[model samples]
Target: MSDTATVYRQRASARPRIEAEPPIRHVAVVGGGTAGWMTALLLAHSGYGPRLQVTVLESPQVGIIGVGEGSTSWLRGFFEELGIEESEWMPACHATYKSGIRFDGWSTRPGHESYFHAFASMLDNLTMTQFVDHVHRRLDGEDVHAHPDRYFLATRLAHACKAPRPRHEFPFDVWYGYHFDSVLLGAFLQRKAVERGIRHLPRHVVAVDRNERGDIASLQLEGGETLAADFFVDCTGFAGLLIDKTLQTPYVSYADALFNDAAVAMPTPLDGPIMSQTISTALRHGWAWTIPLTRRHGNGYVYSTAFCTPEQAETELRTQLGLLDADVPAKHLRMRTGRVEQHWHRNCLAVGLAQGFIEPLEATALMLVQRTASLFVDALEKGDLGAAAQATFNTAVNAQFDGTRDYIVAHYKTNTRTDTDYWRANAANTRLSEPLTRLLKTWLARRPIVGGIQQGTFGQGYPVMSWYSLLAGMGLFPDDGELRAPAAHEPPHSLAAIDNLIQRSALNFPDHRELLGAIPPRPREESLQVYFW
Candidate 1:
């Protein structure tokens, strides 16, 4: 046998085996939408015995907060774990592949007005070292090409309007996610969970009954039916029916750091070929997200009501979409931008908006939900839902939320726009977390960010490359006139070489529109009027 194969076998055999029975046999997930259905699906698929029953309590009267949503690469892993093929769910969800997000006009620096934050791929390993080197050199006032868009393959693919899927001959895998109808996705997951033997209870939670220990005990339905379970998962969006309303978990608001609390969303017709990336353009009061699905474009303006009225935000969005006089309806949403003190409090766990939300700039809503559900499953299996386990889970999950918040906060903090009061306020905001403050200081000092990022607890939310991309993309360095030629001993970077490599790598991926065309199309469903969750 090969030496590598022998080592792999030895390591695989050395791992400890788990044999304990699950502590909780019944898990009730309240509030059905993407969050509830997803949690239910994860629990149903968890290798727990058939004795463990998973139930989703969905209210029929509640409308879905359906928008064209984008996801991070985590969704790809979710589908892989469930053995659900892209061909199966993508068509059903009116989904299109997303390579990454393209930020437009977030910065006003010349040549840095826009940048693409591409999802990392296996191919990045070959070029990331040099990219980091160039970023450092540029920070040192050396003339160099360090734009993030130049080194990443996903950026090239997105620019070319190509899907992330490589040809059969290509050996490297490109990580990617999707843009889909949120409502359709929830429905799709509901179907999958039901098929996996998860029970679906469509009833409104009229009241939450708590045990003497302050943990959730049972839920009273509107129809006078009472449903009890060992553990409860709250996917009740902003209502926090189980976690907040019943358990009274202390909610921490991010309003001081993240100013955008209100959003106006509406759909627009697809005017041309589908693009493979979400576009986030800095608007007057806040930012606008343009997400392309198969049938239409999902456009929304997420702004602070403190700065502009909902009507003004909607008008701006309508003007941007050229629908100012058009009859299409717009959905206005109010967001409570913060997380609860404890995600897994006692017997109840909060997921989705019930847990908390950072803005959708990076399409992290579903990503956070998926992470929480996955972690809860692992904790349940290994720790048997013990107090120590719950504490540990809460600590880790809270850190994750904070870490994601720091990254999103950095976007506003580093923005160079001065066009509006919103931009000026974000620029001058001092309500940053200590971790973010330190990271910014380190970057401003032109020190190695990887070391600080490595030592920090909150930095794990985003990779080291992402920090580099954001800082470098925003042109957060010395003036161009101050740049000097590199020293003789300093190794040179070849922009042409990186460009050639990206162009060549992109050739393997098919056109985004053509790739969607190849997927078997499901019959289009009528648009459902819904509120933003």
Candidate 2:
């Protein structure tokens, strides 16, 4: 070989090589609310605090959508991962422990309508199918006056108006979430994120600038100031400031599958003692959720615009609530049920409402934000997210969204409430996704098998048991001996055993009000402004 070629090869071999791109250093999060602040804090906590500069651009003029006051039990793990102490923020946000949700008046059968989707996972070592079979036998007897929920500890506690005592650590048997003021929750998370050195920008973004490669370059502020970063997170809510308007990402709408499009949210004085769980009462056009916070009840009527006008919905809500007139103030919100075609595109990622939203039926908004943030952190830990990483992230995120949508759709589709066109249309055989349609068919022959719902591309959605709660609550159980043929040597749990478990839990758990009153009060300025959880 020539001397010049030999020298070049030696030098190339001598130099160190970089296996992957450098980790994201500067992240600019646009918008400020629960999603924005939550994203900022989570990113900051993911070993990016001092090195990775996280900036949140929040506008003082934009109002937050504070109706998502309820949450699922998944929030506990998120809070724990961030080392967020419950004592520090719970009271500040007017949060109360939520055991689960209770559904009332959704079924066609008289005198046996209400059922609970309790937080309790399972009883003894029995599988959900076995427990369900045990309950089915009792439900079939003409002389037996049994309710299946009585067997579960969480349900018993909720039915008795009791709440579990607060614990100081993680990994508990009885899972729980919370009902809190969403606006206040944003404020509380903002304080935590800012203290951790996340830059807070109280400026409105007037324009988005893109580089030659069509990636987000910077955000133009109202005063012509430019804020730039290496990565961008769009938490701008429904506006989709960076993801849609700038990148022109396609969106897949769920309008055909889901019907509710608007919500009339209001807060009212506590009519009675605070309960431990959210109450989802089935209404004519849709459902009404009553979330109990420490100070008041956050109530909303989530109804379809096709079935009723805003004025008509308000009137019906008032009638159901027994309100004489507009003594209580109410705000209306329009929602789009869909997701961006790609959650992570180019250099930008959309979180929360900016990504898309389903209704608050299962209180999944915050849960999705938490999941998406964590997933991004995991991806970043491996290497800088290139095309391949972005594809994986998008696939995971889309599966989660689709799974959650199917679960929510199940609530509407399984209902026997045919009192209105809204309910009738939902109950009618509409176009269900291939997976959900198959599962529904399998469930008709027998109880839902754990493997059927839990197996998928994303095995991280709802637990297999949750489907049982929802289906049972909607009165969709199979006939007496049709659930599953008993295993040859399988010993079954008796009703007496189940009743004993319920009695023990009821005796051990404290009343909901007792636990509420025990919490130390935090001092703050009182406000007359109505708030929703």
Candidate 3:
């Protein structure tokens, strides 16, 4: 080891084999909505499965801000990992079947008390000790919804309208999710990423260039077409064209812990069929949401332009949704939650609403845009990305958008409704983040259940039957009665496998228009749909 350390280890072993990342053959995906063709159809079904060449610029006068519609149950494994076929995209997106979301009158303000949080994953090990002993005998006074009561199967399939059936092993039978029509799920994933070939440019990026070691080397459309790429995803929504406008990078603003910041949206049409679930309610300054979508029934409200006054929150959201056009024309928006501290800055990567946002209630804006394009194709198929695997994939997609913005700010700091002035001003303009104020004091003292998958968002939050159905449907049930004894710590004898998984989920639940008459529809712009398989 002499002579300049043997020529610096022979010029670092003849340096020259980065190929600058592989498989992502010429991808672009600036913004097509639904997180730009769901990250260009999962990077064209992984590593450009069909001769890699995705495109999707989009912006024919920019639009797609179709707020969330609702989803979970890992969007049925992201439509079978993109081969797609939930009967060809849930009836062209009129979709319906979400067995969750009721949240009515969010505690205190006219609260008639509620709790079910179902999407089936009814904790195993003697069905979460007999569904916490039927929610501690419905808080010691029985009536878990009366009559030989059983609690949680999303509370007996919400009075038996049922819906999720086909199962072989999804944590174990019928745990569903889907509401659909957020602009027909971005036009049914932009027509199945153009019949699985993908390529569209519509235009309107205006400028993106970058390269002095800054990375994102192309895209400047607006008629002067110039789209180049090795990689770049920035679903351009909150105008962050390539991780905050050509990499100026720097976002992180849960406005001191979420302040509602205004919203409006509309659609209204429901009369029948479309209502598998999704409601929200709770008003006086914020929180509305409805959502049915098989055609229409959206509604939104979201409040707080510093506490009401968007003409008094659209006149209290058209006097609690009677709506004669709930103050007519809609989709107002104002946002200011936060994220993008670095959803991969250099070679560009900022998915959906340009990486970070909270306040869709739940339905996690296309599940963090298919979990940031399936964790950036599992860190580019372990090929090697360095900068510590891009800071561990931008700290695991910024801890899944800051652990779902602290579970949507623990649904407004455990709101017991301070009656108005936006529930009498709380959530102190976003100051909670000390690990979500110590996981909301062990999630409001139930002690331990701080998101398992072993904490810190990567198994993407919500589970424990979606925080046992939104902190026991916002009544926040758990002052430590040790969940009032389900045979005080175990065995009630195989607890009849929760009554044989509720009589095999009642002869395998059906009727959501008979599972859309058993899957089939693959059309778009609406019409011809099915998928009960």
Top TM-score hit = 1
Q: Is candidate 2 or candidate 3 better by TM-score?
A: 2
Residue 166 of model 3: what lDDT?
41
What C-alpha lDDT, on a 0 to 100 scale, does residue 65 get in candidate 1?
83
Reference-based lDDT, residue 157, model 1? 90
lDDT of each residue in 317-376, candidate 2, tens digit only: 888888846588888989999999899999998999999998888899998998898799
Question: Candidate 1 lDDT, tens digit per residue, 295-377?
Answer: 99999999999999999999999999899999999999888799999999889999999999998889999999999998998
Better of 1 and 3 by lDDT: 1
Residue 231 error, candidate 2, Å? 0.5
C-alpha TM-score for every candidate:
0.93, 0.87, 0.32
Residue 46 deviation, candidate 1, in Å? 1.2
Estimate the TM-score for candidate 2.
Answer: 0.87
Error of 1 at 331 (Å): 0.9
Q: Find the 10 residues in a row with the least total lDDT in model 3.
A: 4-13
Q: What would the per-residue lDDT of candidate 3 be over residues 1-533, giving only the tens digit for each residue?
A: 01111010001011123334464567788878777887887777664265558898888897777754888656766775444667778878877778776666667622334444555533233354445445435454343321122444555654565565543333234446788877777888898788777888787888777778878788878767788888888788887767876777988788767788778876766675545677787788778888776556788888778765687777677777777454557668777678878887767788877877786877777778888788887677666666898899888788778877777777777777666766656644347777667655564554444233244432235444345445555655543433444445543334466667766655555556667667643223221111110
Output the better candidate (1/3) by TM-score.
1
- Candidate 3's TM-score reads 0.32
